[model samples]
Target: MADFETILERGGALILPTETVYGLFASALNEEAVKGVYQLKRRPLDKALNLNVASLEDILAFSKNQPPYLEKLYQTFLPGPLTLILEANQAVPSWVNSGMASVGFRIPSHPLTLDLIRKCGPLIGPSANLSGQASGLHFDQIQADFKGQVDGFKDDDFLTGQDSTILDLSTSKARILRQGAISKEELVSALPQLIFQD
Candidate 1:
């Protein structure tokens, strides 16, 4: 395995496997590194990037407000395949959110991903593929798409081949942005008062 902390500290990006699809990762707080991910993926500057955090405290560092029921939601879905959108605090760079007021944060259930985040701080994790392409679900696919584009690759055999379920908790009511591993019914089952956005 590559020294992920060194690679990130040197402003390099990595192709990291998660419980979901492989992701192109760079230190979320490192503006240059984050920009490199955008450049390599040919992703639009306006599109926001999701962050991978090691813990709830990491999420709190970038969150401006603590919404009601957030703890309950986190307790039920965190360290799994759910991504939460929360109001961004000043700690989060504008580049990560594309100047948006809110940002998406996830704590992947994969141990390797969690370890890397713990070592290098939160990471900007976008699907490891060129813009508009399918997400890379395995190392071979990632290598074919980004072998030369990233600093290093972390190999893992486990992958769910699906992105996290995204929930928008930045507002008073919860809204499902993207359904993946976690279903709307599952979320509603946990929090019946939650509202779904059309």
Candidate 2:
């Protein structure tokens, strides 16, 4: 419904499709724009947000404590449906982490999301639906929550209904926050050596 670059350039959040579902995106480094995402989602300030980066190299800049397990996880699941919560580097905003020291980051498998991130650089893409609601995949499903808040809306067939697997790699332990598209069994099999937390 709107231009991707324009929204990011104007410091506005965008509602776009991901491999999982629709997400509201803003520049990861733009504090004001990131705040706008919270307002649009009606999400609380303390919940924190998720970031979509252009490439693996982009992550190195914001990942302070990249343990060997995380590196293995990156190699195994990145450029796919997974979010890695890690301790943020200096470049990440405190607000992005809800004043916490860590941030959740993802490299989505969706072509459009990747393309947009490549264009605008890194961005924060909170869920497109309202807080504590069903995440939408189509614009019609999302219109109620974000009709007025988002600068643009894009609905592709790929993101009809799915969600990313969440992995917390901030500490020495790899915690499975939520199991979505990526199976817990597969993760364990890939990183058999890494410890899994309850």
Candidate 3:
């Protein structure tokens, strides 16, 4: 394993692989690192970003509440291509929350990312491409875009070419906010009885 601490300690953003797509990574709790990601992507503050954890324990740490439906979703969809939108706890920064008081979290299903995150702890991540650009499908595609902005880059041998399915689990009822790599059919099948509000 690479020295994840070196990456974190240096405060450089990293290009990490995720089940959805390659992500530009930074310490979720580091304001400078988080700001660097926003600068690199040219993303707006209101967009915030998603936090990717390496384990279920890490996920629980950032959430305000772990409702029954959320637990069920974790049991079924985690360590895969799913992002759970939930109420943020105090550990998360306002920059990450976009001042919304809630955040999206996931345990990505890419091996290199899981390994690195296990070492570096939870990460704030966004697609590894410049804001408004197409999602990168290969390492070479990401190289020019990321270049010196991030500390390290992992190729597509680890990253999937599409984004994950984002589900808002913050409310009492579940809802699908974005449909991407994970199909609606698969999600509906996973929880057949539940209604997909919005």
Candidate 4:
């Protein structure tokens, strides 16, 4: 297993796989690391990155309110390819959330990625690519793009070529921000009570 804790502590960033795509991951607890990710990608500070958490409990910890259908949503789509956006609570650091009231998060299904998150804690994981570029799907493409500048690279098989579906539950009604592995119709079929605006 990679000593991601040390890698993140020293370098502030690493390349790791997610269920959706390889991500330029950094410790959410480390403001400097979070800054590095944005700088590395040339990503605008105004834009927010999604949090990669170990489990459902972590999601609840960072979020403001626990919706009644959260469990059902998790059961149906999580550890799969769903990125959920929720209202952030006090526990979520401003650096991680960029002071946005809403925070996006994922529970990655890829075993190695999941293990790293479980052992090292929450990470802010954006797709491994420069800002405005298409997300890399293969390890070689990412490695070539990053040009050996990062501390570590854990390559793996493509779990899914598509990005995770971005579902916003921050408001009273649910909305689909970005459609990916999961579909809006699927969400409606699974959780019938909630209204959806795609």
Candidate 5:
């Protein structure tokens, strides 16, 4: 891997690939860099960004009161295409979680992107596009919009370009927020223990 962590350590942002879209990556631990991502995207503070982590252990570290079927989902769809909303613990900062008790976390499937994330630690990765625009489909597409603002860039044109399936498991009732590369039926088939709202 290319030492992408250097820029991240300096509290700078990077444009990297995910299974879905190109992502704007910054250390979730850096409040200033988190703010910089918001500024670059023209995104408002009220909306929270999702953290991109390398493992289920990272998720367990930052989250509390995890659902019973959490590991089942991890074994099934995670590291593929799925976003799980979990209750945030004290380890997660307010800047990354937006003071929300619940935060969305993703363990992206893309090999090069996941490798960099493993090297750098946790990052807040939202779509690389400016707010209100379409999800980034390729490296050049996201890079053109970001231009000189990004500290690093990693491209992968092979990504599916469909957003990950979002499943809200934070609450007592698990629900499907958005279906993307993974389907509701696919998730239900994996873990039939709980009822998933459409």
Candidate 6:
């Protein structure tokens, strides 16, 4: 935890394992740290990053005016593989959202990642692989691809190699931006109002 704290404080990023896939992580609150992720992955500036929080309270801190239906969704499927897009608060830097009004938040179910988040606060967690490449499912893949690129690597055996299901809840009409561990059918079954955008 101390090492992770030090790395993050110095505007460094980490290759951390999540339940869905290995991710390149940096403090969501730090502009430079978030930028480092973009530099490390060579990700496009136009694409936004998603944040991983320790709890619902952390999500509340970074998001504003969340709908009541989200509470139901959180109760049912948080700390799992769901990334919910909500209205961003001032605490969330514009870079994380790519200057967009909304930001995506996820509470991963992995114990180690959750504990790290508990110690380090919310983190900008995008797939560890470079932009347009397949997401790394194992630590070795991440190491081979990004050994010297990031500041540190936190290894773990991930069960699912897929990404999280991204749902845009910022608008009145809930939409699915990306399908991964959670399917659109599951979301619709869980919340009848959710609409599949893609």
TM-score of each: 0.94, 0.92, 0.90, 0.94, 0.95, 0.91
Q: Which ranges of candidate 6 are over 4 A from the true structure?
A: 193-198
- Candidate 3 per-residue lDDT, tens place, 66-176, comes to 665566667787888888888888888788878786789878877778887888867887888888988756778788776765677666675557678888877777777
Which window of ten consecutive residues has the lowest lDDT sum in model 4?
A: 1-10
Cα RMSD of predicted structure 1: 1.5
- Candidates 1 and 6 compared: the better one by lDDT is 1
Local distance difference test, each candidate: 0.86, 0.80, 0.78, 0.85, 0.87, 0.83
lDDT of 4 by residue, 78-109 (tens): 78789999999998888777799999989988
Give candidate 1's error at residue 105 in angstroms.
Answer: 0.4
Winning candidate number (lDDT) = 5
Superposition TM-score, candidate 2 onto the true structure: 0.92
Clashing pairs in 6: none
**Which segments of model 5 are wrong by more than 4 Å?**
none
Per-residue lDDT tens digits of candidate 5, residues 1-198? Answer: 336878889899888888888888999999999999999999999899888999999999999999888898898877977999999999998998889999999999888889978988799999898899988786776767888888888777588889998888898888888878888778878888868554
- Give each model's clash number: 0, 0, 0, 0, 0, 0
Cα deviation in Å at residue 102, candidate 4? 0.8
Model 5 global lDDT (CA atoms, 0 to 1): 0.87
- Considering only N, C-alpha and C atoms within 3 Å, which residue pairs clash in candidate 4? none
Per-residue error for 96 in candidate 4, Å, reads 2.0
Higher-lDDT candidate among 1 and 5? Answer: 5
lDDT of 1 at 44: 97
Q: Over the stretch 6-125, how does candidate 2's per-residue lDDT look in tens digits? A: 879889877777777877888878888988888877789999887789676788877787766667778888888888888888878787887677888888777888998998868988
